[model samples]
Target: MPGKPPLLFDEAFLRKLERLSLVARRARSGYFRGERRSTRRGQSVEFADYRNYVRGDDLRALDWNIYARLERPFIKLFEEEVDQTVHILFDASASMDWPPHPAEHHKWNYARRLAAALGYIALANHDRLTVAALSGDAFTPWGPERRRRSIHRLLAFLSDLPAAGQTRLVPALTRYAGQTKRPGLLFLLSDLLTPEDLRPGLSTLQYRGHEIALLHLLSPDEVTPSLAGDLQLQDVETAARQDITINATVKTLYRQKFDAWQGEIEGFCRQRGIHYTLLTTDRPFETLVLHFLRQRGFVR
Candidate 1:
């Protein structure tokens, strides 16, 4: 890991991301006050709507202009700017760590940077953030923190994390959902190359009230393989081995299946209102956070 680049965004980059924030699709009601606007009435400067004043209501929120005109007290309900929780679930399974090739360092490394950028944005804007690495059954969680001061902790946790073992996506997600006390925006970053179907996991998160975003990552080599004939392939997770011959026909067929699988994942997420994006390890991480994610309305 000596030649590996640093794990964090630079100060200038951090400053830029500080101005951006994750978008809350709906008015979220959270326990603490934050930068995100909510449907519930609160003491924020932006006003939302008004309703008839009831007993025990605060006198400060009562609109004197409406009362003088109609003789009925109307309470002003301003849009409440409250904290929105952002959970980044990163996949640290063995398959994510491809080796013996240049792309071996790419997938998990890119994911870490992506998580760091978003986590910085969340913290800078005072949104609660929890980053959990999905290694197996019970994963490791770093935080449910909101302050920018915790950025160091986030970076450290992500940097030192190791990728290993087989991760059944469905089970990992189910466990994560069960432990999540509050849900806002959940980003699941993974290759999703596991044997388990991703549908059940996605559905579980959706049912638990988490706004899901799937960031599907694949190495460039994995996408467009240039391997020759007589290859011994081994599964990174299961250690299953198979000997096969790679011909022109094999490459063509593999490409077709790969494209189809990507399409299928996209369609599944779309039907369920989950945000999905396919990214290659070679793509600039900055482009993903600054352009691709913005285009999807993930960050603004």
Candidate 2:
């Protein structure tokens, strides 16, 4: 019999993740009670403010001390604690399976590990998390589950996902925004190789009240190509071919265009108040999570 597959995350790494939790810069409304503090005022131990007592108000909420001093009834209000809905959108398109050799650092593998780590953090903090893999026209999803017990299911779901088909970001995102009723935090992990204008999809999510964070993943090979001589490059997803000579001028132009493309995406994100981070698969997983993500304010 074959040996069992290795776990996506070791116990030591999971324990480290337990120390962190997803951060939402602004308050969000959730259906279930949890650790996150919300803007909505409700019954909780932490005091919010006091308001003049109105008819039919709960007598138990009346501030006896204020009543004695002012001879007027006042109701004590408390800050509401609620769960956050965290959505992780993973891109499993063909381009993400690049650099066929060295499977460990493949874009697909790196992205899956990152998703698993983030989902675990949310689970540890009792936040509702939904993970979806987007490819072609399909959106495969798992969980709106919370708590550490759900980590196993999350890992299994992520491990089984395969990268294939073209990435159709707009339709997939638009459909998700329409289907998901509650608005919260949304993290999109993708290489963003699609030619479609992403503004429509991103704007839709924002309109639905989601706090969006775009993790633009790329491989080191893609970022800095070392190819020389004549080359026939084919699009991984579309299979279109292009023949070009790999000369000094060509390489210089390629680098300039690549940088411009990245700048365009960054500018768009900044204008829309969306958090954007560019990541290369060559980076260590621990550094990406423990250091980079923390610096980005995604976790604390």
Candidate 3:
């Protein structure tokens, strides 16, 4: 029998999470009442501004004190608090299941933990949360659920997700961007090992008005391989093989190419107002969530 999956969060960690909430840079209209302040004025207790009273304005909103002092009726506008929709697009492509060995700091496992932590924060704050797994042509999604009660369901979905198939990022992202009518904060967790150009998909999401944060996951071996001598590397997704001789010069070239690739992605994200963070599997997921994310203004 398969051993039980490790718990994603402990009770103490969950208690700490309850104090934090996902931050949205721009106000968004939400379906249900929540902690986020909306752009629209409503009946919430927080005072927004005062506007000249119009003919059809609600009599209850009239500031009687202002009317008495200035002899002009002003309507009090209160800020509306509403829930935000949070989307976590997790890449469960074959590249994420790197380093093969179970004891290693698996990229897939690390991504899942990050997703779970973010989902928990959203749920705790009563924001609608959706967790989607993207692999090949399939985009499996789970919930637009709100409240702490849904955390278990979110964890379960992520725990059962398997990393397989090629990374079809563009298609998956385009489809998701087209289908989601309401835009909010979107977090993408992926290894991003695909050869496809990601600009089109990212642009589509941005055009649809979603605030995107890309968490680029990588393993230590991928960043700095220790293999030496001539060997054949088989692509896990396509089963394609490549012959290469690992030498000091080759290692230097590989590092340069890798750095250039990462710099390109970061530059693209910077130009498009998308938040990009490179995460290594060896780093503690808790530190990424509680410290790095907070420092980056993602959570508070």
Best by TM-score: 3
| TM-score, structure 2 vs. true | 0.78
- Give the runs in model 3 whose Cα sits over 4 Å from its true position: 1-4, 7-36, 39-80
Shift in Å, residue 118, candidate 2: 0.6
lDDT of 2 at 64: 99
Question: Candidate 1, residues 67-88: lDDT per residue as tens digits?
Answer: 9999999777553432568899
lDDT of 1: 0.75
Query: Residues 84-155, candidate 3, lDDT per residue (tens digit)?
Result: 688999898888877685533778777887888788766755566888999785689998787568888887
lDDT of 2 at 110: 81
* Residue pairs that clash (backbone atoms under 3 angstroms), model 1: none
Report the poorest 10 consecutive residues by lDDT, candidate 3.
Answer: 24-33
| Residue 124 displacement in candidate 2 (angstroms) | 0.3
RMSD of each: 8.5, 9.0, 8.6
Shift in Å, residue 30, candidate 2: 14
- Winner on TM-score (1 vs 3): 3
- Pairs of residues clashing in candidate 2: none
Q: In order, what lDDT does every prediction score?
A: 0.75, 0.76, 0.75
